[model samples]
Target: MVRWVRALVVGAALAGMITLAGVVLGRIYADPLLVRLVAGAAIGSVGLSVGMRRLPNWTVAPLSATVLGAYTIVGLKLAAGQADVTGPLSQIARDSLVNGIPRLLTAMIPVQPAPDTVVVPVIAAWLAGLAAAEVAVRARRVLLGLLPVVALYAGALYVVGPNASAAGWTTPAFAGLAIVALATSARPAHAEVPEVSAKLRGRAMAGAAAGLVAVIALGAAVGPWVGGQVSASPVDPRRYVQPPQVDSLDESPLNRISGWALSPEQRLFEVSPTGAKSRTVRLRLAVLPDYDGITWRVGATYRNAGRVLPQLPRLPDATTADVRQEIVIDGLTGRLLPVVPTPTEITGARIAFDAATGTLIRPEQLSTGLRYSVVSEVQTPDVNLLPAADVPSGNAVARFLAVGPGVPERIQRLADQLADGNGAAFDRATAIEEFLAEHYRKVADAPSGHAYPNLDFFLFGPRAQGGQVGTSEQFAASFALLARLTGLPSRVVVGFDAPAGGGAVTAGNAIAWPEVLFNDLGWVAFDPMPKSKNPRPVEEDFTPKPTKPPTPPSEPPTSADTSSSSAPPAALAAATDGGPGAAVIAGGASGSVVLLLAGLALALVVMRRGLSRRRLTVGTPDERIGGAWAELRDALRLSGRPLPAHLAATEAAAYAKEPSAVRIRRAAPASEAAPLPPLDELVAGINTVGFAPGAADDAQADRAGSQAVAYATALRARRSWWRRVWWSLHPGPLRWRRPL
Candidate 1:
């Protein structure tokens, strides 16, 4: 009865620890389903571990596996609504397994609790609970058992990364429960100790309690000081993980602006207000931020997403209206999904979303009759704050300030002339927009292209030289690049101006515009279209008489003369800013190679971890015993020391090795970590399992597997930190048939 009570406390503590660790996922994924899934997995694992404590070790592992699979299937079915689970079970399972971890890192947050996104967290919590309970309760190695729980908590922290800061109470709560579990666990019955007098025992207990109190008080005083010294931004793991690539992203939407203009009357799509009606809606299809002289492409990293898309931080002084619209595709093509600016929620279709760019894409092509619903938060900035608003600085927005090489010197001069005397970034942005609208002409059939040459001709080429007339494509691109050259941090957007009050959107409504990024206001739209008063409405076709281009005095408009004694050198520096020159591009290419190698290295680690998991968890009793020894051999090879293949199993312990400095807790030194529980016993078990058929049982197999992992961990820990890291990441053992 006493043992049963003790087991209950330990099991509850383990389950609670896993559950507390799982709260980190709640921040990453907003859905309440995560709560149910995590709690269910934690409780179920603990119950199974306690129930199976009396069973043979091999039988217990297989039973646990069976239960875990069933739990996952049920949890997934619940995540996908009952009506939505009409698809084949195999498809659901495949998607869950394939997208489980990959999408979690790349998906925008707060991620919806889709089956794929929830699977990883649920499984991790379950496994952690089961392992920790089994070790603490059955094996009676309380400290050793805490390792799995610690790993789960660390993983949760790592996966959440910089997305969310954990609550203040979480760490302290977990630590407190862990201490309780340790205090409550029953000691081994085989332990023998001399009896101590009551007085001495009380004194010893008092001294230990006083020491713990002193440690806690000291930590309370020093913790805040140490925390203040650390960096504000946490290390984000998403940087190392490559985002999903789609072939359709290669097709630039900016290139299609002119083509759409030629067929202006063709219906592209239609939008109907599902909620509050609005006077106008701007459905953004793509945001083109990257330009390499030839073309502007969408540089967003789109990841698989669910109904609730990630939203930007709301500005305190900004007024926002939620406009919900139901959109139906009529003649739209390609994979780009059009949504109103600053979409907060989406439904009616599966999509990949890029939060940074406020863009969405259907992995599959958009077909006629396809429909989706979107809820957008249209921001109304306080005009009072516009004049004083600043632009973001540092490496975060540096890409927006970068200009491709070979910008015409006249364009820079013109930008300077237009934006002269404007102290604020917003004022300069409006000045440029006002000048372009008043000075440029809009033509119905302007040719496509927004390259450096094209923009130069539009801004400075003589009228007779095919200059001064182009489509919205040229106007928007010119504005964006020119803004970059003036250090305003801008990007071009390719979208449609749907009819006022929401109706059919025709190709005629296809428009391009520039948006300037302000520190507090986000991306504020600017209209540089000819004859345009605001971002809405593409103007009707207009013809203009040819005008002579203005000629610069003394210099004859040379491209090399980007500087002048007139305006701020900052503007000229931006125009001539060799941001990412040839050498930088070369270094970027080199970095790509290094990333590819690192990805391959990570793949090897995953493959090896999977192999190790299967060897211990799958197969018959005899096969498991043999697998344990094979694991040890691989560990030996990875640790930079391998016994000869020809060496007999009995000779394993006798292998020569020098002592090392590192040690794993109270275990043997690095040299002695190779042999545990007597090498002779391990050798005899392996021989019996391999040759003496039917001689090994589940209990013996389980023992060998456990011993192997402990041995491997200790052996690896003995090396220097760098060598240990390399040992974990190295892939040489996978290709080698035998260790030397």
Candidate 2:
């Protein structure tokens, strides 16, 4: 009875721990089926392992494996709707083994509860329960049994990353169960404790009570400090793993803008509101952020995603409302999926989404009649914040500021002239819009080209030279480049301006526009298209409101005039107008600067690593001990804390109390950054080698180096992430004027 009761306690505790660990998968998976599968696996594995405890240990493992295999196979098979015995059970099991792990890692959060997705969590729970049960019941090692459960829990947390955190009760619940198992296994099954003398028992009880009290007091003193010092931003493990690449993303959807314009009356896609009220919905198909003088393309990494998309890092001061649209593809042909900006949820089709660009793509090509529903978090910026908004510096948004080579001098000067009086980024953007709308003509049949030459002709070339007329393609491309020249981060969005209340979207509704990034207002859209004076031609393409035709340039260029311009020296053109040779020289210089910086950083790291290695290995025992202390001081220097050459080891460690050093003396307010006692002990060893010892042995030297390495590691870990990166790259320690 006593053995049976002990087994029951072990089984119950292991089951609780395994189940709790499995439930952490809720962060990544939304399906209730996953929770149920994990729970069943945990309970079954624990029960079977405990029941077969009387059997030989080797046999018990085989039995547990057989049981788990059968359970997992049947569960997966039934979930896949292939319950027939004659069906491909072996292949189902094989695919699950082969593809399951990768699927879990790459699948988007709130993952669909499919057979492959559920297999990993179910197997994990069963193995944890089985291994934990065997150790606790047969081996009689309760605390050791907690290893599998702890490993499972940690793996789940890492896989979830910053997606979601476990609930409040989970930590306490696991801790409580672990304690119960430890207490139950403290004594032998069916054995009685020998009675102790009253005096001895009293002393033992008091000692236990005192130890418990000390632990409680320590926790109370340190808990809040530890919590406060933890980084506000959790390190996301997924960043280290590369997102799966798609080949379809290479084909720029911006190229389709021309084709859509050519067939204006053709139906493209239709949008219907899922909500009661209907409003105008502007769907963005793709964002073109990269241009290479030839064509524009998307510069975003699309990852496989589920219904709930990742949240943005910062939410500007804006009124955000959820707008749901049921969209149907009509004649739109491409892999790119049109979506309202900042989609929160998508259903009815599989997709790869880029959160940064708010773009979506169907890995599978879109066909006529394909349907999907999207819930978008539409933001309306606070208008009052617009005027005060400042554009980010060029360094901060270099990608958007980038323009290809061979930009005309006239274009740059024109951008400067138009933006000269505008004090704010928004004002400059608006100035460009007002100038374009007032001066340019927007013809429906304007030839499609957005290259430098095309825009050059549109802006400055004489009308007799086929200049000054084009579509939204020209208007938007020109505006975006000009905005970038004026120091505003800008990107062109290609999509359709669907009718208000959402119905049939035709190619005639297609439009492209430029958006400028503002500090507090986010990407604000600007209209540079000239207003249409002509009434809409029913069943035809939408034409922008036309302005009076732009005046011809003062002097129409003749062949003689062209020849005069071309007569300039190639070197002069390169110097004056940013020609091919200038571009090459500029690129080469920039590349050289980057290489120099990288080489400097590599040199610093190599020198620091070599210095520490030589300190431990190459020097005499006594000298090595001294080198260890030097290495510790070097690490401290990396943190930007000064340690004077005259100071003793102990004095130096104490004086180096810059917040991240985990100071030995309590100079700061009570927090997690309190003194490190290990540093004091290491300092004592340094003092002994330098002052008291005649000679230090090899073991003593090795120990000193090891301890110094540890202390330095802890000091480095306490600093912020960017500071740590700088600490590795800094040459301050290597260049110290005088080594201590």
Candidate 3:
């Protein structure tokens, strides 16, 4: 039952671990379902395998450490999007040595956008530590081994940080070395305590040491080869670039209001005239005081709004006038109170007041505390200017105009009326504008809403229809549409009305108006709002100086080829206009430093091996000749040759017929001399004196063994050159063959 419970616990833990891994990987990579599932399953399996294991705490500790450590390292890389490192383990070690611990640590850290490759040793080391910990005997030791693993987990948080690449190696190496040390320190089976037997243990240690050296060398060599493969793959540039613009207005109500609102309280103009002004001078200035349901953009051209009457006098030519003035305002009620206009266009004027709202207006609500100056062009009639045919259509400034609601019908009607029986465009447009302006009554109070599909609202509403006055937006739309109907191009312009009295106007005092397109003259402004005897021109208070357009930034060169010395100075200058090449240089220098360190490590390992004592005890001539011949026969079988049945030792030697065999025969005792030592005697002497048993005490056995080893070494040295000759002279059931 305990075992079943353990299994159940393991299963539950596995499921939880899987879920955790899935969440982590999903968040990190956003990979497809299949990929994420596979990754989660693999990670969970590792965790489950360790959790279910029955072992001492010490052993279990290292294994657990290794597993979690590897997972963390791999997880970081997976998150960072780097490809796995495919080179040998030794190369990873070498890289650690040269680049210092930082780079390796970085490799371990997971970056937001993962790289194409991940380091495999980091993962392997982690797994090794985890596996080792699982078998640990003491809980304390397990905890101790895991301390570094915990630190590594903490370090991974910074993997995607600036030093991420440098931090990657820290946890993996710490975990790996700890596991290796702990595993090596553990006792063998049946041993109550750890003991290091001098002779046997020394040999084992030597073998392990040699194996490690070899692994390191192999890894170094293999790492570059693997790196080469990775470098050979192509990279796509477009994958890393980002797009250009994002709208700032949609989500914010403030921005929306700022972008689209048109309030009449935000004065449209302040007017004053030069010379003897009349007691009642009509103030004419374009005004679009409020925003209706439809939006009015900056730039678009439209046809006239009403019928063209050829019987009307010709309209005056377009002209421009700059007007400036000031008016005192009442702050308590936010109203423009009546004040005598100095240098006013008309005298004896009294500002009309809206008693219900405590506001003053000459048909429009005026905002308080605004000051501005404006430059506008008005076409004053001269000799009843005759309307022309052939209306002008295209104009560049027309792109900046836009219409409000109810605009399309007005434009169509104006266009149709102007084009009436007159095929020419200019005459039709002129006729339409003149007829509409002359017929439409300029009233301060129009109905709350204009009549749908009708032109009577402006002519008869409010004072005529008994409803609250319609806003300037409705009036402008109606006017612009009718103008377009007569073939005249027109548009609605939204801005602020600046009142005179403040120092300088700001965006808070914005206004709007309607503009019509004319041939050669561009957009001409005309105000349809009724004016009092003492008129205030809106443009005079807020006209600002023209601003210069901004210059574009230059782009720098990105390609290394362009920066080459042979390129002209101008070419180089042009190429470098974008940004400096510091990143490229830094990366190259870093890579070079890594390579140098790797090379130095390899050289050190080689030099150390060459200086070691084990390298000095190789065999003498007799041993080489005899042992080599035997080894050569064994090798022949490995190479797929068959040995002869019923072959005597002497026969086998004769069959080999090597030059070494001739040397062996010559070295043997004569028939008369003491009988030659048996092969068994020689074998025993070699095993006891040279290899295992002490040889220092017996000079004779030592000398004989030395001679045999020397002979074997010499035979091996010459074997290759003599192989063909020896085989041709004597062939056995299976001839000796060279290794492939």
What TM-score, over all chains together, does every model reach? 0.62, 0.60, 0.23
Best by lDDT: 1
How well is each residue in 292-318 modelled by candidate 2, as lDDT tens digits?
A: 666677877777676668766555678
lDDT of 3 by residue, 1-740 (tens): 64444333333332332233233323323234323433444344435444546554456545555555555444544533232223444454344335433332322112112222123323433443343233232232443444433443433332333321233343455445455544544445654334655666788899999999999999998989888854353332212323111122211111222322333244333434422233332232222222232433221111111011011122445343433344333221212323221111211112222211111222123445433222222234332233332224333322322224454332333333344334333344445434444434432333333334333444332333432123444445555654543334566543334333333223334323455655444445556443333223222222223446778887875577665787887646655676556656788999999999778656654553342212223454333333433443432222222222123344433433432122222233353123222334334443443354344334444444444334333433333333433322222313322221
RMSD of 2: 22.9
Task: Rank by lDDT, highest first.
Answer: 1, 2, 3
Tell me how far the alpha carbon of residue 453 in candidate 1 is from the true structure, in angstroms, after superposition: 1.4
* lDDT of candidate 1 over 24-97, digit per residue (tens): 66777766788678888889998898878888767777788889999999988887772133367778778889
| Residue 377, model 2: Cα distance from true site in angstroms | 2.9
Better of 1 and 2 by lDDT: 1
The C-alpha RMSD in Å for every predicted model, in order, reads 29.1, 22.9, 44.5
Error of 1 at 521 (Å): 5.3
